[model samples]
Every structure is written in structure tokens, then in C-alpha cells.
Target: MKSLLFHRLALSKDKKGVLELSEQGQEIQKADDILKDPYVLEFLNIPESYQFLESELEEKLISNLQHFLLELGKGFTFEKRQYRISISGKHFFVDLVFYHRILKCFVLIDLKGGEVTHQDVGQMNLYLNYFKKEVNTEGDNEPIGIVLGAAKDHVLVEYATESISNQLFISKYQLYLPDKKQLENELNKLLDDEHDNSASR
Candidate 1:
């Protein structure tokens, strides 16, 4: 029963001791439902100290497309890379484009080798607006944009995205695998806290 429930939605606890679910119950209703917060890109196998350019990162992901897709979670279908969009004879390229079968929306990803800036957020918003106005056909949902970076300033991201009407998000990617023991310890701590809370009540 738990496995079946998980097939519909994932349940986990956050640092504040709040239990969170991936979705309401059985279906993906929004972009956040399908996206991971910090995407793990350990399969790329780039060294921790290596300072790679955005283009190199794209190439590595394309070369390992299958693993990349799996890391992106379910329902993503690759559409194009360096997808071109023109404005007043000026051409801009999106790093990666994907279509979510379940969400019925185009997903645009902009890669940043360093920390994300407000300009990056603005650029992604522009891409999303263009997709909505010029690219989306009838019955398609609003396009979603992800500004992917190696690091993010949460306060800046909040300020940059707070007023945007477009469906946009900021996330980080790690080249190396996370420490399993640390994660296990955190999870165990949360579980213990929950158990103690229940008993106290």
C-alpha cells in the first residue's frame, strides 16, 4: 500500500519537521510537482574542482542524455538544444528545451556555470513569454522556465522572481553525488522527532 501510494505521490519531511508530499495525491498539477530542488548530476563525472563552461556542461548532458533525463524525473521528452528564438533580428538561444508529456508544457532550461543572476532569471522569463506567445499551440499549458546554476542566492532569487507572472523557477545542480550517510542521519533524526511528537500528543 505504501509503494502504491508513493507511485502517486512522494512524502518526506523538511528541516522544519513538516511532512511534505510531492503532490496532492495521484497526479501532477504543476511544474513543482515534477521538478527536483537540487538536481544530482553525478553521472556527468566531472571533477569537483574542474571549472567547466556552460557549453561543455550542455555537451556532457547531451552525451549522457538517458541519465540526464532520468535525473530530470519522469514525463520529460527532449525537444532541442540551443533552441533559437529571434526578436527584432536578434537571435537568442536556449540551452535546453524539453516537453513534459504529463504537464503538456514546454520546459526551458538555461545553464549557468556560476551563481544565478537577475539577468539570467529575466532571460528565462523572456523565453517563457516567447514560448507562450509564439510557440505554444492550442491546448498547451503555460511554458515553464528553469534557471539552472551551480549556486543560487535564495534572497536574490526570491526578489527576482516574486513579481514575475511567468512560470519560472531557480535550481542548483551538483556534479558529484551527495553523501548518503549524512542524508540518512538527517532522515532518521526527522523520523525520531515525529515519533516523539506523536507520543507527546
Candidate 2:
């Protein structure tokens, strides 16, 4: 009876082994199929939307700007916003100032509600120049400036940066998240066209 029981257990294990392996293989195949789909790939790659100052009150926006900077990625640490600086006996406030550890200097950011203008970039450059001259340490690199706005004109931005010696960057801010399906569809169309061209070649 003991030998018969042992034999039965062995047979049961042998019978289910192939079935379990087959199920695992099927799961792997499904995962691979999902990964190979262009829509899925594009959805995974889309960046998260950034929050803008205009969307919230000034006090709240100042408080939350640190999180916003992290979402911007790269090396950034929130130093102060609406930071006060005095030049030639007049006082000025800088919006969204940060210190970049990697860049080893202060980063001054200006927020714009409407279209970015040359004046906006100029103000940022002025802040950078002042900070570099007054606040920067001897070992610190030159301060950099960034102007983020609702809408930016590329030509205007290019013109603004032409004569500036300081490191400057301009980026557009989005209040709402991107549409996943729309982004996916665009990526899929581009991928399909590329595949077709490669096949023809």
C-alpha cells in the first residue's frame, strides 16, 4: 500500500510538470507581446506633466515649487523663491531660485503666465549676474538662469539668448497632463512608417 501511494504521487507530479511550464511560457509570451506593441511602449515612455505657479496661489505655489523642480529632473534643489536682492539701493525679488549641486552654482528661474518675452529672459540674466557678483562663493561656478512660461516663441527665445554669456535655459510649463492615447497613436504611426520603409529597403 505504501509503494502504491508513492507511485501515485510521482505520477501526479509528472503529469502536472509540463502543464505548469506551459502556463509560465504563455505568461512570458503575453508580456513580450505587450512590450512589442508600439502603443504600450510609447505610453510607458511619456513624461509626467509639470505644475505651474499660475495654477495655485502665490503662497501655496511657493511652497510646492520644490516638488515641481524635482519633476523637472536633473540636478536641482530649491533654495528660495521670491528671494530678495538689493542692487544700487533698489530691491528686487527673484522667482524660483535654486542651487544645482552638479552645476555648483545658483539657478534662477522666472515664471511667466503668458508668452515668454525678451524682457523675461533679460530679468533672469540680471538676477544671474547679480547673484554671481554678490552672493556666489569664490569656488562656485557662474549662476544660470531659466525662464519657464505658459507659451514660448522659439524665435524670441533664441534672440534672447544670443548675446547672453551666462548659462540660460527656457522651458515651457504644462498645467495639464498629456493624453496617453494620443501620444501612443502618434508614436505608433511613426514606428509603422519606419518599419514600412525598412521593409521596402
Q: Which candidate gets the maximum lDDT versus the true structure? A: 1
Error of 1 at 42 (Å): 0.7
Clash count per candidate: 0, 0
Q: List the residue pairs that clash in candidate 2.
A: none
Local distance difference test values of all predictions, in order: 0.83, 0.60
Model 1 C-alpha lDDT per residue in residues 98-133, reported as the tens digit of each score: 999999999999999999999999999999999999
What TM-score would candidate 1 get against the native? 0.82
